[model samples]
Target: MWFNWLTALTKGVLLMAIQIVTDSTVQLTAEELATLPITVVPLIVRIGNQEYFNDGQDITNTEILTHLINDTELPKTSQPSIGQFLEVFDRLGQNGDSVLCLSLTHFLSGTVNAARQAADMSATDVTVIDSLSIDRGLAFQVITAAKLAKNGAPLEAIIAAVDLHRSHTKIYVFLNTLENLIKGGRLSKAAGGIASLLNIKVMGEVVDGELQVAAKGRGKKFLNKQIDAVIDDIKAVSPAKVGLTHVDNLTTVSEISQRIKAALPETLVTIHEAGPVISTYTGIGALAIEYYTD
Candidate 1:
């Protein structure tokens, strides 16, 4: 059911049609969305009494950062409802087009589960994929699938290619503050307080669909060393694409981008601001490095 065919009357031919769908956590620009054959379903972010759709257009990351810095209540994010996914799937598959829906890791969110439920309830042939990643890490896979679909590749080939890319992709995050973690109940208040008093920074990696802290140290020197290590690792792999995403941490992210470009001139590098759902958890001054190897 993953593959669907449509008849073309021009030459009496049968052509394969596939549609790419993903949640808004994937870091794609407006231009990319307009140009690519990909559709995004948005998550919801609630701060106090106001609710915002995380589609970038409904609420900008800048506004989210300001609220996080000043608001008393921490922002809350929710996965898109099954009905939302069902609507998208139904529309895309209305004309005999099979749909490929990729979602954020279920470890961090229930988006994949919602997508799966919607896929089952819909009449269309829908395949839901747990990307096992977020942001640019997820975007890389979505873009790859869209490109393959546009070229009329078979469903199996698209899935295999996406799997290969996912295997080679790596995500590393540096948390400049532990306040969000503590507020979100991910870290104990006592532990976060101690770390904050010592001005500690946390370096984490996304592995097996979960974030695991890899290192912790104090001051700018420690942060620099970790960034250097990440850069060195990227150099070792000679990645095909490097994406830098952050929540209002432009200076540091820009520096890392320059270093990557200098070292890997052939690689494609992109810079994006972390969206609301991501910003809510990352807090201010958080940077994420997404690397995809050849």
Candidate 2:
């Protein structure tokens, strides 16, 4: 469906063309990213002494998981520098095109600030927006803006549409292990140790630009109940769109996708492998869902 849309866009004339820019944290598939009118600025990823750019390049979720399983130092991620964003903004705007920059939550990373600074330096009209969510949640807003832009919608209209989706969209994360959070210093060592001792599964939601616990329990059954409750909430939002992402956890993703599909047959679902920035926090075997509830 997306391919066909792109084909039509290529064949038709566009009166108002807008360029969409987003960082690598948005969990969009390579094919999807290639097909859209979007430019992705790679985030900086550091593992041990080696450095990688998430510019749709050599790094992948599988490689990140392998490092995690080997007990290598927890991967560290950083936002793109202002210089990097300035370069991308200049390239994408060279054709006198308007650019809309969608960035991951400012609370989680300084990528948004970099984009904002670059926008101020650019000669073209650029609007930078904080997605307030990462991974597929960020993907949701980027995709919506791309579609609106493809239809020749003005930049302001597309920005308004993305902002609306950002408000309604939510990301739910199910952590299969507490070690990553502990290693990354996101969770206190003491708290992580307690959760591990009890065999607890942590569930959290990205709210108000931060990840916070919504519910958690002792076993997978409780996780299933939590998934069901999330599905119920999505159902209440008529004609909704949903996205699912995982860090090398296909079994859990398949099960959750089946449940969500069975419940909301008409809802659109996009499944993606979590990218480097997101995988750094989610770790191996983490499953997440992103959807709109309005």
Candidate 3:
């Protein structure tokens, strides 16, 4: 189905896409990036990175591929600026279709506001939604939007579903360090300053539209306890769709998945490497589990 879509997207045709900047799926090569119904925004997207876009085998550029293979990783920037997002909205407008953008948590980043600004000026119709969550946290919302657009669902309906689900979703996380949050300015001075004295570890979940701490762990072993809390919370909600994501730590993801399976075998759980943008705050050991419980 993905391959078919690529074939259909001929001649810089306008396309409907779900743009997300999370720890996982963000660094995919342009070819890898474009394969999804998604547009992966890096922590930083450079001016010339578009040259390597691999729309398909026929469209793949050897020079670009060569650069990609030789370079350690793609260069990224802060969440795309409002002007940058406008460019994408404008281009898609040429194809006579709107874009539905699913963004990471608003509390976590300013990316949503930037996207809204761009959409306001876009010639095409654009709906920017705040996932209000992170990790694969936003995956289902993105997937549904993409699927709806692919199946010719009206832009308005697609946007509505995205909005509805964004409100329904919940994200739970276990942070290995408050250092990442501190650096990202997420942790208050009281929280970060006493990180050492408190020997801080953060275990939190989003409920009623707020990031609230459920517990604090002092070290690695204690993180398991936090995971236990997460599982218990999930059990109470029993979401139909679920995912586990880690910034740079696949190890933690594996460990959590096994636990989730044991605790909630009926739920579907997907594991993903965190994309660069999300990692900026979540840190290497940052792990998040998200699902829809209602």
Q: What tens digits encode model 3's per-residue C-alpha lDDT throughout 1-294?
A: 324444546556555543332222222334334655565443342324442122223222233334333555433335556777787777766756667777766676677888888889888777777777655656767766666666655566676777777777777877766665665566566644565356578787766545666677677778877777767877777787778877656887887778778878898787765544455455556788887755
Where model 2 places Cα greater than 4 Å from the true spot, the runs are 1-16, 185-199
Please give the range of 10 consecutive residues that has the lowest summed lDDT in model 3: 52-61
Give the alpha carbon lDDT tens digit for every residue of 54-117 in model 2: 7657687778778777855788988899999999888887877889999988877889999999
Residue 173 in candidate 2, Cα distance off native in Å? 0.6
lDDT of 1 by residue, 1-294 (tens): 233322232456766489999999999867778877899999999988888899888899889988998988889889999999999999998899999999988878899999999999999999999999999999999999998888777788789889998999999989887777766655566655566556588887889777767788988789889989999999889999999999998998898999888988998889999999988888888999999997
TM-score for each of the candidates: 0.92, 0.87, 0.71
Clashes of each: 0, 0, 8
Q: RMSD in Å for candidate 1, one decimal?
A: 3.2
Error of 1 at 68 (Å): 0.7
The TM-score measured for candidate 3 stands at 0.71
Model 2: worst 10 consecutive residues (lDDT sum) = 1-10
* Model 1 ranges with Cα > 4 A deviation: 1-13, 185-199
- All models: lDDT? 0.87, 0.80, 0.62
Q: Which prediction has more favorable lDDT, 1 or 3?
A: 1
